[model samples]
Target: MKTWIVLLASTLVLPAHASNHITDSEKKTPLQVETIAQFNGIPWGLVLLDNQTAIVAIKNGAAYRVNLATRMTTRLTGLPNVDNRGQGGLLDVAIPPIANTQNWLYFTYAKPTSEGSTTALGRAKLDNNHLSDWQDVLVTNAVVSGTKHYGSRITFDNKGHVFFSIGDRGERDLAQDLSNHAGSIIRLRLDGSVPSDNPFVSDANSRNEIWSYGHRNPQGIYYDAKTDTLWSNEHGPRGGDEINLIRAGGNYGWPIVSYGKEYWGPSIGDGAEKEGIDNPEVVFTPSIAPGSLLRYKSSNASDWNGDFISPALALRHLNRVSINQDGEYTETRYLEDLNERLRSIAQDDTGVLYIGTDSGKLLKVTLNGS
Candidate 1:
């Protein structure tokens, strides 16, 4: 294994402006990025089990327990059979924030079916080297013919609800449909029951578990308990990637009102704005292809506290968006020189960041002069 340390310079300060064409800038903070370990498959999701140990979900239907202190990895057993098709496999893994459910680990993966596959949320307990009492919390009704656009990422609101995202499943119209679970954010109780207060629970035409709909392919989601915000970043067709402030029952206008062009070069939907649809907080025109998101909360002041960080898969950079009190934000890109397709990110107790790349490498990032 090889290790490289790269020093990141300070971000330039820029005024917050409109969501599209937002510039990148930040306060001066030196950063050091180091390669810590290498894995056999793409580390799709990373969650810290404790201060020194983490569980990583591989994209090819495997999981591993990685010790950050000694750089040793143990292959975890007892995971469900995952369909390792295109963009389908073992995806995001998360641990509940509440104290009582800390023993349970949550997961989202592509569960195979007769038609095709669907994103399923499941949970289990880690028993030494194996998982015990594994249970599928919810098998989403999103099976389709293709294998792309699974849109599986997990987050919790710390208020007895767990939220996960599912893509449009390669069907554009499914985003606007309420009958199925595709192209929506779902909220459920920790035990797999639908939350009564969910946005669409009362409507017989909609799925009871849906929180919001009209999403293309949200790969990154984070809930901020302090501000009561649910944030998501999703991909667009040719461009127009978006970071949205998700709201209950809000329609985000995927194919209906997109700023992106179709793959072959025609505009999408009724221009970029519609009356009732919610607009994105930030939009990326050329598509960074965000894989995972993190709301950085740290005791240290220099660690970009309270900012949104995402790993860019297509652009191969660490993307940061700094938000102010008014909900306006700016963007900053880091580590573009490394040229790695960053896949997942998790932060430790000491404000250090651990990043997983599509190249099967784990990286550690720290504030250099802090």
Candidate 2:
């Protein structure tokens, strides 16, 4: 028989005053420990796949599969060669809709280029303990000269087409260039082809794959189950981290006009509000260095009905932002005690919450709250 431990948060605070953001009796404890893999560095991406397999991304161009029941980690193959410099490497992964029918698993990484470095998407079929028939799915149009700011986060729409977040590639002006795919959200077909219905497909001045533009280095993307909406969290320069409601062809202002300041303590742009540029739904003042995003199941959440929980690398905690029926949000921070720089979060169909930490710990947190 397997043993189970139950832990509840109970923090004691001053009786004179209290705050709405934090409860006086809030806490969390580790229920179980299963150290599947210990890397020399941080783990990048993690998501639970169907049929008892889970996917993970390691920084140095490696991806693996873990069996939750058996705690068996089998390193899969076919990841792109990445420089693994300051902030560029194998970034994020997603299993396309074709995975069910076509057996295709998609991933993104930095491809070494002559000019500098470029981010590219690759797809491979997960066969018996390995990836076979790998294909380079998509490569961004803009050529990057640096190893930083390659936004390779990939998510799929309900239509079976794909949506990817491309970073500004360290060049602020490229974010405003409609002709460039960098610093934009792109929509593409499953076979590395452009979608005809993309936001800027017909405009001669705009790249056809551009779904939305003006993002910095966005790492997280999610399709909301409750609202059927696309949501993302992007990192800010000094401060001013953002959580955005991703819309087709929406232009989210980056260095053109950000809520953050420059490294020299100067204004990033004219101001936060600029004409025709979309404001973030939420912005962080102190800067959380946000990572990947995952929504929570109400069945396991105690007070929150259903909330979008984003991981923070700088703060090393998870942010739980709640949404109304209409998709408007009210925010709360959950699982502060995890004290781990959570890189990714995924839930199994059975309500087991799996979180990947920067220190290479893959945690399965099962909630039992009344």
Candidate 3:
């Protein structure tokens, strides 16, 4: 095992520009980082079963139970066949918060279809080293030609609903279409049933599972039960990656309105803002390429309580954003020295953080003074 002790100094505060009375404060936290385990493939999803154990999902359609103390891994079985093409494969895994449903493990992966590949949600019970009662809960209607935009991640709300994201599947106009599940966040009951209170449940033309529309590729979705807030971070073409406060029935303008420029050096969409579209709480220009999101609540490290953290792929850092009561944000970037494409993040009961990197390294980060 290798270890590194680093002190991270907070960066300059950037104005959120959404609301007033945003305060800027500087924080200096000493970190103890340890490379707990290594893999041959990217660690796409990570969830802690307990303080000493965790379940990790690899991008190559493999899952493992990892021991945090000994750095040992046990392979898990019974996952459905996933299309490991382009950016599609085994993705996020999450455990529901409710006590009655806590035994079931939820997952999102790229399911291969006759037409192509689409994002799918599934659930299973962990029986020793293997999965039992494996079932595909929802096979999204997002099949298209390319595999680059399967923006899938799982999170559960305080209510009995599960939410997951799907990218535009490389088709830009599909984000605005209500008939398909592409480029949208989907909400469903724990048993794969559609909730009647969903935004488009009554619209025959729209998919009943849709919670919100017009998202490009939201790779990360986190629901904070304490604040009752849903947060998402998505990728943009060249610039304009966004961190949005997700709202039910709200439209987040994507192709029709974007702060990003086209790959061929042209402005995208009608403009950056439109009347009915909801604006993002934070926008990262030049694309940090956030792969996952977490609303960190640390009892051990009180300074980090209620902060939002995401792993940056393009910039290779741990991105942290502090949101004040007035909805203002102060941003900070950490761990650039590691130079790994951080993909997923999770926190333990004692407030220790586990980060999954694209380089197949599982990192454990702890606040030194805590």
Return the top candidate by lDDT. 3
Tens-digit lDDT string for candidate 2 (256-285): 788878877988887886898887877776
Task: Estimate the TM-score of every prediction.
Answer: 0.94, 0.87, 0.95
Candidate with better TM-score, 1 vs 3: 3
Q: Which pairs of residues have clashing backbones in candidate 3?
A: none
Instruction: Tell me the tens digit of each residue's lDDT in model 3 across 88-159.
Output: 999999988888774799999999988898999999999888899998999999998688889989999989
For 122-145, candidate 1 gives per-residue lDDT tens digits of: 999988878889999999999997
lDDT scores for all predictions? Answer: 0.87, 0.73, 0.88
Order the candidates by lDDT, highest first — what do you get? 3, 1, 2
Instruction: Please list the residue runs of candidate 1 whose C-alpha ends up more than 4 Å from where it truly belongs after superposition.
Output: 1-29
Q: Model 3: residues >4 Å from true position, as ranges?
A: 7-10, 17-28
Answer with 1 or 3, whichever has the higher lDDT.
3
lDDT of 1: 0.87
